[model samples]
Target: MIYSFRNSGFRDPETGVYNQTYFMEVFNREWHRHIRDHQSLALLYLCPHIHETVKQPHLLEFFMKQVQEAILRTTDLVARLNNNSFALGLFNIDEQGTQIVLHRIEEKIELFNLEYGKKYTSHVDYELAGYTCTPARNLRIELIFEDVESLTHELEMEKNKHIELRQMQ
Candidate 1:
């Protein structure tokens, strides 16, 4: 049987991205398919750290658009999780591809800052958490949701080190 999740109340009303429920359903099937094909599966959580979201109703929309442009692939899926954070399901993507996507996201943020940095006096500070799963018997399916906290914390620490290095330079 064929099914359409778009209209099944699985979409986020604000950003039009899939909600966590829909993401879980889709990711499970995609994960198995990728494993069978011996392909890599990448998941990313994109969080904006210091945005003035309460004052800007369009903040989420802009971030969503930036991510969409960066991914630019029809196969990838974006979902809004329970914590209001966004996640991307990147099928058949590798570690290098994940880094490229992150760089692109950073470039997009920089562009936005260049345009509106002085006017708003606040630039978009993003914290990204990425996980890549290669086809393996030892691979864990629960890591996607379960490891988000630790993953993001690690990412933040890495970003802090980079910031410090740049300051020293």
Candidate 2:
């Protein structure tokens, strides 16, 4: 018998990585695995800043592609969740492990900035927030963060403050 495989084709056309639809499917599977196996998972949400310096929208896509290439691991799930937000699902990992991943991503961003030269202004600046959970915890993974909106607001404020400080220099 001949086998015919069907592809879901759920990837961001611009970044060539999983889109939100694929991400949600993978995330649900990982969540189920975490519940069944008593494993831990980390959800990192990243928001990229929009800047006037970017002349073309495709450039933003290229920048995100660079980010995806820099941060993704064989086991990690990365996806573009929205126009300016991306999400990463780290399975069977702890807080420290998540921190290490975040650190590496930040380092890659810095390296990308350096490589792009001093005169070019980058269109993206990432603000990251995360949540960690395990099966044994008394808390519900979905309810761990009750106020993502406020948290994201605070992060944006903090980022703006940093940008203002840099402008002063």
Candidate 3:
């Protein structure tokens, strides 16, 4: 079945997953719900190394599908933020819980790499980076959204900085 919403720009045509636009929308809604209900939420940003391995377009699709299925839960939401980058919104989870969930996802990726790397005729390498946040009651959803947005941006900047430093070697 096609999983998409009305006028949803978050749906990626290649992997049939929600895109960043959908992520922000869902996150804002969930954030409001959490604020009202006093629940917790976590966000995970996943960067797959599929690009470093196979140049084949179809292989990337397969890799995305596998990663999507691996990390997603019935209560969780996943989005393709851009090429080789994905994000997850996990509701009602705290920082430690988020860490455990992310570890499981990492394990799944490793297992898939071992199982299908040779068969797919592609080298497999991947890395994951994530952050968790639980907003305070007094905080507005818009502020929380901005905080997460800035956090994500900072994380990407740090990653790029590290990459640049390594490349300078």
Give one digit per residue, the lDDT tens place, for model 1 in 1-169: 1245656588777777778898989998888888788888777777766444547666676767777788888989998885547888888887778778778877887787676576676777667777776645566777555565467666677756211100000
What would the TM-score be for candidate 1 when compared with the true structure? 0.81
True-vs-predicted CA distance for residue 84, candidate 3, Å: 3.5
Q: All predictions: root-mean-square deviation over Cα? A: 6.3, 7.4, 6.6
For candidate 3, write residues 70-121 as lDDT tens digits.
Answer: 6557778888877866777888887677776766776666777776766766
The residue pairs found clashing in candidate 2 are none
List the candidate numbers ranked by lDDT, top first: 1, 2, 3
Question: What digit string (tens of lDDT, one per residue) describes model 2 on residues 58-79?
Answer: 6556666666666667788778
Give the winner by TM-score: 1 or 3.
1
| TM-score of model number 2 | 0.77
